[model samples]
Target: MAAREYGQYCGLTQALELVGERWALLIVRDLLVGPRRYGELAAGLPRIPTNILAARLKELQAAGIIRRAPRSRIVIYELTPYGHELEPVVLALGAWGFKAMGDPRDEQIITPDSMTMALRTAFRPEVAVTLPATAYGARFGPAELVVRVDGSTLDVTRGDGPVDVAFAAGPDIRRIISGELAPDRAIATGVVEVLRGRGELLDRFASTFHLAA
Candidate 1:
């Protein structure tokens, strides 16, 4: 089936033509953190049907928003240079929509990419500036991500690496980030676990990043 186009010359309309389809922007969101193979993308977006995922990938590729490349000798889908330029647009949209979020229910799923991207969305350079250089790790369910802070630079990357502090968190990470639960209390309540390093690292993390209320 042909993609539905807006048939307009407006920049916003044109952009939507390329990415406004269902699951299209979410695919972009998944890749924003980094490249991913087909399986990884599928796993991250469990609700998307397999055929729809494949079609979206093709659409994104045809629009030059994403491209296929080799990572570790395996083909992966990554954003093109033009596609990477959508970072600000995506972040802005996320920030704007954040206020609407309340809480998740028992059936709702929060993907790893969503959490990691939220880390980027909530990064506070002002807070990072006061901190000593360190890397913090959070393992929530099967997903592992690391946050590296140096001076005012904070980077969150997928997968576990050498980190100064590691936290094994439950779905309560959102609660922790939202300040509804203090890290220590979450740990004490068995909702979060300090897998490695000082338990205080959680406090430092809470202070360093914010959800913008």
Candidate 2:
């Protein structure tokens, strides 16, 4: 079946013609964190039907939005060079909608990729440039993320590695990032833990991000 068309010549309409499909932007969002295997993408978005996922993948590929490559003998979906340019667009969209996100419902699943993406949206380059460079370990229950902070940049990746600080991140961390909770109070409540020596970095890190307000 042919996809629907806006029948308009505007650039926005044309761009939307490629990514306006349901779940398309989300597939792009998941890939923004990094490449993902089909199974991993499926796991991240369990609600998307298998048939729909396949169709979206094919559509994205044709639109030059994403490409598949083999690594370690397994194929993974990754963004093309042109597709990588969508980062700012996605980040801006996330920030624009951030202030409206009060809380998640019980059934809403917040995947690790989504959380990392939130970090990307909240990152303040001016604030981060003032902090020291270090790799910190972030564990949310069983999932772990390597969050590295460098001059004017913050990168979040999925893995376990040598880190200067390690901690179990919870709502308190989110509250701190959202500026709803103070760093001292978060620590006092035992919601944010400092497993390493550089505990001060956590405070600096928390200060570097906030919901778009």
Candidate 3:
């Protein structure tokens, strides 16, 4: 059970009581990337206090949203089947919140899990199916990802790979994702830097992965 409860009998109330505490859903978000050790989760969410992380883990385990499994003499946290069902919900929530994300605060930092979910949220498979298969090696500050789109499928992973375009950007990449800035303009204004590969492929990237703000 969660540390705090709403004392109501509604479904939404029940759901909130289960995972509504601060940093709870964020823990879920990181676990969606894959199983992670306790330290890994802490590292991904650097700002979360250690005690809060421990309590949230216990609460989630009690609700069957997550489970601990022993691996190589260590314990790791992974989402349960019921927890995996939150994928669509989290993605939708992320998309909704993205509309209000104008800029990153000075202290805010991007993590691999968050970036992976962002790519998944912005991917337009219907539009991608009509274009040539492409890949992008993207570096947003210290976070890096290889975004691959084939037909209507998309795969994003941490690290660089053979890609049509390899570009770097800061949080302003949201401008391109929101279609608020054209790719050429983004490049011209120094909002994005082409590290390697043809710069024109950025146009393809902008088309394949976008979310209307």
Candidate 4:
């Protein structure tokens, strides 16, 4: 429950009361990726204060959005079945916000979970289904991911692997994804670097994962 009530009878109001506190939705975002131990959550959300993390966890559990469970002999937090329903809402929010994300600030950094959600948000399933399967090792700043696309399914995981193409880029890669810059031009401008394998595959990657700016 929220610390304070809006004293209104509305679904949105009730939803806000449940998870409108600062950092609450972000906590839900990380949990949407997978169950995370306390330390793992804290590491992913580097800016969250320890006391605040604890408080949010308690509030979420009390609201039945998340639950505590023992995993591998340690306690981890995971979203409940009802909480899993927020995935579409989060993805829509990500796509909506992408339009306003022009450039990242110096202090802004990407995390694996965030990158995962971003890719999921922008993935074009119909286009992907018409293309050949491909795997890419993508490095966005410090976040590394092995992205695989088979038909309409997209899977993103951490670490490197045998990929058709490997590329590194910073936030500027958004231009390529948004089709604002051609993959060839992005490479020429140093906005994207083809680290290994066939660089042409990057065009395929751009088509597979895209969101108009």
Question: Which residue pairs does candidate 1 place in steric collision?
Answer: none
Taking the tens digit of each residue's C-alpha lDDT, what string does model 4 give over 1-213? 788899999999998998899989899999998899999999999999999999999999999999999877899999999999989988998889999998788998889888888899999999999999999999998899999999999998899999999999988888988899999999999999999999999999889889998
Question: Each model's TM-score?
Answer: 0.87, 0.88, 0.97, 0.97
User: Residue 99 error for model 2, in Å?
Assistant: 0.9
The count of residue-pair clashes in candidate 1 stands at 0
On the 0 to 100 scale, the lDDT of residue 145 in model 2 is 84
What's the best-to-worst order under TM-score? 4, 3, 2, 1
- Off by more than 4 A, model 3: none
lDDT of 4 at 86: 88
CA lDDT scores, all candidates in order = 0.84, 0.82, 0.93, 0.92
State which candidate, 1 or 2, has the greater TM-score: 2
**Steric collisions counted per model:** 0, 0, 0, 0
User: On residues 86-171, what C-alpha lDDT tens digit does candidate 3 reach at each position?
Assistant: 99989999999999998889888888889988988999999999999998999998999999999999998889889988999988
Candidate 1: where is the Cα deviation over 4 Å?
70-73
Full ranking by lDDT: 3, 4, 1, 2
**Cα lDDT of model 1 by residue, 65-145, tens digit:** 999998777999999999999998988888777766777677776677987778788777898888888898888877788
Candidate 2, residues 48-158: lDDT per residue as tens digits? 999999999999999999999999889999999988988998999888877676765556666789879988888888877877787778876545788888878788988
